[model samples]
Target: MPSIDLTINTDLARRILTGFIRSEIGRIGLKRAVVGLSGGVDSALSCFLAAEALGPENVLAVRMPYRTSSRESLEHAQMVIDATGVRSLTADITEMVEPYFARFPEMDKRRRGNMMARARMMVLYDQSAAFGGLVVGTSNKTEILLGYSTLYGDSAYAINPIGDLYKTQVWQLSEAVGVPEVIIKKAPTADLWAGQTDEQELGFSYREADRLLYLLVDRRYTPQECVAEGFNEAFVQAVVRRMRRNHFKRLMPPIAKLSNRTIGYDFLYLRDWGT
Candidate 1:
């Protein structure tokens, strides 16, 4: 059994993330970032880093709230706005999604949630054009690994500073960057509906998932090895299944190869490709 340390060097991680944000956005000659503030620590940390990298005036924090979204989520989003002094706006998604819901009353919660996620991205990209900034993503490494994000919804972004950090590590960096304590302690949610939480929906806490993921993915541990290390066999299987199943979400759309210089296959150099 290997000792797993989920803790990150927040100070160093913070520096690397801020530098990453600054360079990735600037690499394309863009000086601004448009982040969807969900009032969760993931988005909050991204916003903090964006504000630091590009200055608050250059970062636009957009709050897209569905009707069922809690008042606390909205307030906490405002907390990030105030704490970072980033330019901000709120785009209510109820009107945008309600018509579709009315048209298809048979849509289940998952369907509606997916719709809301895509709708939010539509809003974010539209605002991205007006703000002249790239969309900064909010999904952390844990959610990314678990396939916990909508395909082009929450997962869509021009650059992601904390995409490598786990959910627990997101908290550590959030505190180091001065995110609100209330936000740091709150139950994480996508706010797709009232009274919904991430852990409840995922069927396990991120603390547990992160530990297991560190072994399975980072340590390259076998599933049986994880069980031998005291993790429940079923839990190990579930996480392993998700990581394997969601592998497609981690990559670009596959292109069929007929030519020898197919994009993403052999023509991999992105440098000098016209910004």
Candidate 2:
């Protein structure tokens, strides 16, 4: 099997990401951050970075779990909280999403999963306001590029320190930051449903996907070139198609260009223009 080395300088990445979290939060005049900790390596790494950037006391790790979420998820999340000394809250999202789930008894797992994800975001934003902090994002480069995240759900964040890192890189940094061993070793999942693992849902392992994405995006290889680089043709085309199809999820909602100074177009500037 063709393999690629995606190893990163964990120490350098740690310093840069921690500095990014601090500066970005401070830029907005906030000294604290709230992260949705899912007991996955991604969120665990994000929480560790947030704690390092802002003191543990200033970082709030919220564990929003559905009723069917694994007990191990809660346990692993707590492990991060215990390890980081960050303030923690466990908000069950089962009730928040059950009303809608009950309304549509026939709703498939995909619709239900999206609802659960959005519900978790709602909890995070609410906690962000209550905790006086911004939402630190946990979605990594691999997931973002493949459109593996839900719009306005896991994808929403004030600032994302790890969005640029691939899943493999997340593991590297997670280990450097002392994320629990179990989290680093476990199969990746969003825990939206009982048995739904990320690889199973996507039909590919993150290792393979990361290599293909690195070649296609970072190395600027075309689909044909990627296939030539030893990736299967079908895998390359599927990933390319998904990336193109979900391009809208990576962007802000388009505003109709009705005026000379539209919000997203002509009048593009920081919200704190004079501050």
Candidate 3:
């Protein structure tokens, strides 16, 4: 049985991702990139790469925090800005999200959390137009595979350099790209509320998830194969079920087929589609 080790060449990965950012931003005829910083390793890695790719002055790292967001998250976001010399701003979504939240007094944590994520996205896109930057996403392969992100919110991005990377691989690249050690070592969170950690919500650590996900997704291991390779059967079933349930979140809203060349179904982006 092949063991799951998602180790990647940090230096090579950095060069490729930075190049990808530069190329994608240039393709959009923009020299600037905007990143919503959450003081997490994923976003920190994106900030570093974008700054290197588009020059620090051209990269905008926005901290869109809710009132319940942790102080450490805000500070760590600033640390990333300071380290990369990226242009930065702070947008407090507490005020922006208050109206709906005030109106719906009985909203649960999941509903409220999704609202906050979309609220931050609203701030990022407004800043994108103001700063002449494209919104770069921070989600990695593990979360993307696990459906751990809010769609059209944290998942909304003009382009993503790290979507192909696993969470464990993200930390490795972060170190090589000079991301802060403190940011790299901290527990991951959406900062939707105080005392919220991603692992606690997911009921599994990224380290464990990465290994299993690499086996299941990247290597295309069947659940039975994954179990045979040492994963607990219950855990394998649970992960598979989660992935299947959230598969729709990973795709664009489906268009009912009518014309042979429907917009999303057939009118796809092609090489040299525009100047």
Give one digit per residue, the lDDT tens place, for model 2 in 33-72: 9999999999999999999999999999999988899999
Ranking by lDDT: 2, 1, 3
Better model by lDDT: candidate 2 vs candidate 3: 2
* Model 2 whole-model lDDT (C-alpha atoms): 0.93
How well does each candidate superpose onto the true structure, as a TM-score? 0.97, 0.96, 0.97
Give Cα-based local distance difference scores for all models: 0.92, 0.93, 0.91
Model 1 per-residue lDDT tens digits across residues 66-111: 8889999999999999999999999999999999999999999999
Per-residue CA lDDT of candidate 3, range 194-262, in tens? 899999999888898888888887788888998888888888887888898989889889989998799
Off by over 4 Å in 1: 271-275
Candidates ranked, most accurate by TM-score first:
3, 1, 2
Error of 3 at 154 (Å): 0.3
